[model samples]
Target chain A: MTSILEVNNLTKTYDQFSLDRLSFSLQKGCITGFIGVNGAGKTTTIKSILGLINPEAGSIRFDGMEMNRQEKQIKNRIGFVLDEGYFYGMLTVKEMKNVIAPAYSSWDEQTFSNWIGRFGLNPNQKIASLSTGMRMKFAVALALSHHADLLIMDEPTSGLDPMMRSELMAILLDFMKEEGKSVFFSTHITSDLDKVADMLILIDGGKILLNEEKDTLLDNHARIKGDSRWINERTRPLFLTLRETPYGFEGLTHQKEALRQEMPDAVFERPTIEDIMLAYVGGAEIAH
Target chain B: MLINLVIKDFMLMKKYLLFLVLFALAAPIVIASQTKDDSLLFLMPFYLIMITEIATYLQVSKFESISRGAAFICATPYTRRTFIEAKYLFVFVTFVGILFAQIVASFLLPSLKTGLNLNAVGAAFLMVSLLFGVLIPCQIKFGFDVVRWIFFGLAFLIPFSLGPILRWYQSLGIHFSFSLPVSQTGQILLMYVFAVVITFVSMYASIKIYEKKDL
Candidate 1:
């Protein structure tokens, strides 16, 4: 697979926090789920790729085009869905569409209409009147209508209801069925990605801890639960994170089979994306 | 893209359109009732120009900041240059539109015609251009808070300090004459060229500042 987006050593510093030399790549025709704790630099990375914030150092290449050099053309082929609605609330849906349609060369009115109709969004309704879910749907519809090859979303499903979230997942799945399309969305909701994302990236403390195919990442990591005695000084390093209770212990590890051979009585559970993320991010808190 | 951006601004200003119409109609009546000299009537629109220009700036600046519309525009396929160009061009269009409306109104109402006195018109144009030259860059670079303070400072401070400053200057034996040389079409043309230069310079500075701004 070829990378549609590649970010290398991207850095941006602020007084309180910094995005440290972040690097990641999104392959063509795959959904890469960007999972991170709050303030883990997901948005910063996304902004750097989009050139919203100029990085202090490093480079971003979209489809082999340098982002800073070919910004306008690269951006035309990429769709962005922001966490919050960035459109003017005073504008009706139709007016907002009119404002945005001219910006993209491949804007499709028929596709836009179909998405709007599917979302049950009234074109005449002022954007401020829509609920958060509806507004997100509208944003997604707008992004997909422009014949964009890559869709980069920042926590678009953060506050959505289950039904809306499921519908959005379905829409993304449908969008990916077409050739040469890819998606990169940052989200705290791992369950949403568990059902949809092909690749999973876990970030913590401004660093990437894991980037692997979702199935592979899940298959490799395991949650081990058993008596606290199973966690000894020699075996401690094997657990990515471990928590002990009065009666037992539970922990996550990547060397599941090796650890299982050592502690034959221990129960090993398949780790979810959430488990993997927590092991990386909640390492300090859960460490024995 | 620039045209669409301007159109978006116009759409956002939809509510203000009715007020503009009312002002257009009521301006003539107010000026007619307040002044006996018809030549001075053109000055009403000049004042209106100042007020409307400031109002438009405040409105759009407030909207952009509040809606976080700059984030949207920045994320889109637009270049910072194009965004700034749309804004500068939008101001030019608004200035022309209001000026044209006033001039047309003057023609329809014979008393309001000032017979194309280049001096007054040229001075008004220069003043508005300078005002925007200072204001737009400040607003674009420093944001609404700084712009608001600068506006209030100028509004209150200038008039309040005028008498004292003049007196202080007089005490220093600094005497100046308030006079104008005989005007010609060439001088009028030169003033316009100067105004255009100032506006464009300000626009270029604004674009540079906005380009580096980490919005």
Candidate 2:
């Protein structure tokens, strides 16, 4: 599959934190989930991609065009939904649209109106009056109305209830039905990605820990539960993370087949995305 | 694209603009009737124009900061250069519009007609342009929050210090006087040219400052 967005050696630094040569890409027509803990450079990376912040070093290319060299043209084809809705709160919905629509050459009023209706948004209502879910929906509607080929959303699901999250997921799934469309969704909520994300990129401490297909990643890692006696020095190195109780021990490992041969009584279960994330992030913390 | 950004600023400030217009039309009439001072009549309209310009400038800046609207706008197809250009253009256009409105209103009232001289127009234009020329670059460098406090401080400090400063100048035993070797029209033209230069320089500085700023 062709890549829609690519970042190579993307680096940014603050006094306290930095994005240390982080890199990732999104395949065309795929939903890529970007998962990281708070203050883990998720917003920094997204801002770099969108040209909201200047990176110390890196190249961000969207659809084969370099972002810095062709910023206006590149931005015209990209849409973004920030964690918080950064809209003119004083303007009514239609009035705000009037300001924004002229900025995009491909804005479709009919499509925007359709989305407004579908989302049950009143055009005359002030933007500040809308609820969080409604604000996010309005943002998505604006993104879609501009015929954007790629959507870069920064924690679009944060602070939303489960039902709103589900609705947003449905919108993303529906948006993906079109050809050559892509989404780069950043959030710590891994459950939302389980339902819709085709690819997952996990980051921690300004570094990318894992980038793989969701199914392939899930298929390769498993949770192993067995007696603590089986966890010798040799076997201990095999598990990515281990937890012990008075009864049995539970651990996470990617070497499931190797572990099974050694400990035949061990139970193997499919691990959720959250479990995998914790194993990677928590294990890294333990190592540090 | 630049026009769209300017229009957006106008839309954001529409309510404030309405209030400013009402004040511009009604304030002078009331001040002239109450004070019965012709000089006050002249100063009030120009003062109102300056206040309108400053209020609009500060309102847009504050709104953008509070709403994070700058980040949102930069995310659009508009470039940072375009955004800066739009702001300068928006302020310039607004200044001219209010000045024209004040001029038209002056013709209707005989009491204010004497104040509408070429020197008055030139002085008002030069003062406002120079003030914004310095202010816009300061805003770009320090951010609106810091610039706002600075502005408020200067507003209070200048009037309060003027008397003492003049006394201190007199204590120096220095007298200042000047006569330019030019016609009144030529002098006014020079003032206009200087204002334009200051404005462009300020705009260039603002664009340079904003281009590298992390939103």
Candidate 3:
């Protein structure tokens, strides 16, 4: 399968935070989870890919077209749903539909209406009046209705309740059932990722820590817990990141079987996406 | 797609902009009772207030505010140059629309108790164009907040202490009166055209600068 989006060696720097040579790609017809903590350059990476932020170096290609120069061509097929709805507050949903529909050559009015009905949003409701969840749903609806082959969303499920998130996941799953549609969504909600993402790309400290199939990542990274003293070289075989506490040490590593053989006292457990993510992003404050 | 978005922006602006323009027109109608130089009284305030609001609307986006930062506009398919060009074009079009409306209003209404000067309308258009041309570049360079401060400082400082500037203008024998070598119709057309062309080029340049902006 071809990559729908490819970000190559992307770097964006600030006085305090820098995206360090970030590179990743998402294939068509898959749900890719972009996991990162706040200020971990998750939004920055998305912004860079969207051509919202001009990076200091590297390039983004969509369907093999340069993002910066061929933005119109690429954006035509890419639908983006930011965390919050970006629309005139006074505009009714109907007005938004009327206004935004013409911009996409393949925008489907019927599909848009169906999503609105599915989401139970009043088309006549002013955008300012919609709750955050409803607004997000509306954004999702718009993102999906434009006949876009690739959907790039930022924290879409962050504000959603569990039930709504489940609904959203179902919608995404149904969307993927059809051919040639892919979604790359960024979020801190690991459960959502676990539920829907086909692949997980863990990012922290302005860099990609791991990019692998969700199942493989889950299978390989095991959380081994015991006393801090148990974290010996024999157990530290090709570990990804190590987190220590006074009670015990939890090291995320793919060498679980070897470590288990080495230390019979250690308890090895399959790491959830959340556990692995926490291991990468945890600093002094979070360990508590 | 950009054109469609632009249209959307205009439609959103419709209610507020129409209200402002009508209110400006109504001012002269309400004050037709004034005994003074009704033409100057009617034209100046209408022009100034309408232009101020138009500029402010473009600056502040009275419709809705997007918190994703201005970078959002940059990330879209349209480049900064094209984006800025669109804004410049929109502002000019708005200016022309206001001018056309007022011109029509001037004819339909009872005499300003003082007749309107076609010349002042042209001058006002030039001033409005200049205002946007200068402010948009400053806005592009300094951002919305800092530019607002600079603009406010200049705005407050100029009116309070313009004696020297006024004197310098007097020294140059400059005047607003028609008696002082007003342009011929062809020259007037040329002057307006030149002003518009200059503003457009400036706007185009600003757009290019915006395209390269880090935001």
| Two-chain DockQ for each candidate model | 0.73, 0.77, 0.40
Pick the winner on TM-score between candidates 2 and 3. 2
Point out the higher-scoring one by lDDT: 1 or 3. Answer: 1
- lDDT by residue (B88-197, candidate 1, tens digit) is 77887777777776777776676766633576667767888899888889888788889988888888998899999989988999667774574577788877888899
True contacts recovered per prediction? 0.76, 0.85, 0.47
TM-score (chain A) of candidate 2? Answer: 0.97
lDDT of each candidate versus the true structure: 0.85, 0.87, 0.73
Q: Could you tell me the interface RMSD of model 2?
A: 1.1
Clashing pairs in 3: B81-B207
- lDDT string for model 2 (A69-108, tens) is 9988888899889989889898899888887788888999
What are the runs in model 2 whose C-alpha is more than 4 Å off? Answer: A284-288, B33-45, B167-183
Model 1 misplacement above 4 A: B115-118, B158-183
lDDT of 3 by residue, B1-215 (tens): 45655565676666666666676566555555454565565565345545554553554443423433234344444445555666666665666655555556556664652334545656666666777777778777776676667767877898877988888888998667554354478666765786787698777768766666765
Error of 2 at A225 (Å): 1.7
Judged by DockQ cut-offs, the docking class of candidate 1 is medium
lDDT per residue (tens digit) for residues A124-210 in model 3: 898889998998888888878878888888888887899889988888898888898999989988889887899889898899988
TM-scores of the models, in the order given: 0.94, 0.94, 0.85
Report the error of model 2 at residue A24, Å: 1.9
lDDT of 1 at A270: 87
